[model samples]
Target: MIKRLTKHGNSLALVIDRPVLDLLEIDDQTPLSVTTDGKCLIIAPAPDEKRRQSFQSALKKVNKRYGRALKKLAE
Candidate 1:
């Protein structure tokens, strides 16, 4: 959807749709990451470092327990 930037104090702010925020499971309290690649502007929820570490730890545990079985199944 096309959106226009709204004036906010000395800055222009883009208003995100409620449904879009709901779909992404992000609330006003959620930190946002904004970046651009020369031409296009990208906006998304910032990566949670703690969550990433937790996931990595869980993956290591699972791999240690089932790595051989999983490898055999893949073959």
Candidate 2:
């Protein structure tokens, strides 16, 4: 697919439309990490550190809650 760059101040910006944004599940506030190989540009959603930490915290609690039962089952 071809895309045209629009002017954003002096620099050009590639505008991503709603369909593409919806497909990626990212919105305007979502942060992205951008990089490129010699031939192609790679774009992806950056890790949400806060969300990761919260999920890890929740998982640790679940493990703590069930650790004894899990250990007994293993044995």
Candidate 3:
């Protein structure tokens, strides 16, 4: 299905339909993370608390193992 961006003040907003929202398990109370890959946009339900913690922990270990050089490259 196709969606168009509607005018929202000075910005554009895409209206997500109900079926897509349901498939993503996005309830009104849940938050979403919005990001872009330069060429495209991504919208997803935020990871749960446990999963977020695990990801941050794993990232710290990896950064420590790689030292500061890898982090510099990311910048």
Candidate 4:
């Protein structure tokens, strides 16, 4: 979707759509990380360290429990 920045005081702000925010599980309270590669801008929710650790723990357990089956399926 195309978006145009709106004037906000001395700076411009991009208003994100509600549906997109809901899909990304982002809210007003969520921290956003903004970056660019010189050609364009990229905005996204900041990584949650706690969430990352939890996911890693679950992944390790799953690997331990189903590593053989998963590797077999990959073949």
Candidate 4: pairs in clash: none
lDDT of predicted model 4: 0.96
Question: RMSD, each candidate, Å?
Answer: 1.4, 3.3, 7.7, 2.2
TM-score winner: 1
Error of 1 at 28 (Å): 1.2
lDDT of 4 by residue, 1-75 (tens): 988999999999999999999999999999999999999889889999999999999999999999999999999
Off by over 4 Å in 2: 51-75
Better of 2 and 4 by TM-score: 4
Model 2, residue 67: what's the lDDT? 87
TM-score of candidate 3 versus the correct structure, residues matched by position: 0.59
Q: Estimate the TM-score of every prediction.
A: 0.85, 0.64, 0.59, 0.71
| Model 1 CA deviation exceeding 4 Å by range | 73-75
TM-score of 2: 0.64
Off by over 4 Å in 4: 60-75
Q: Is candidate 1 or candidate 4 better by TM-score?
A: 1
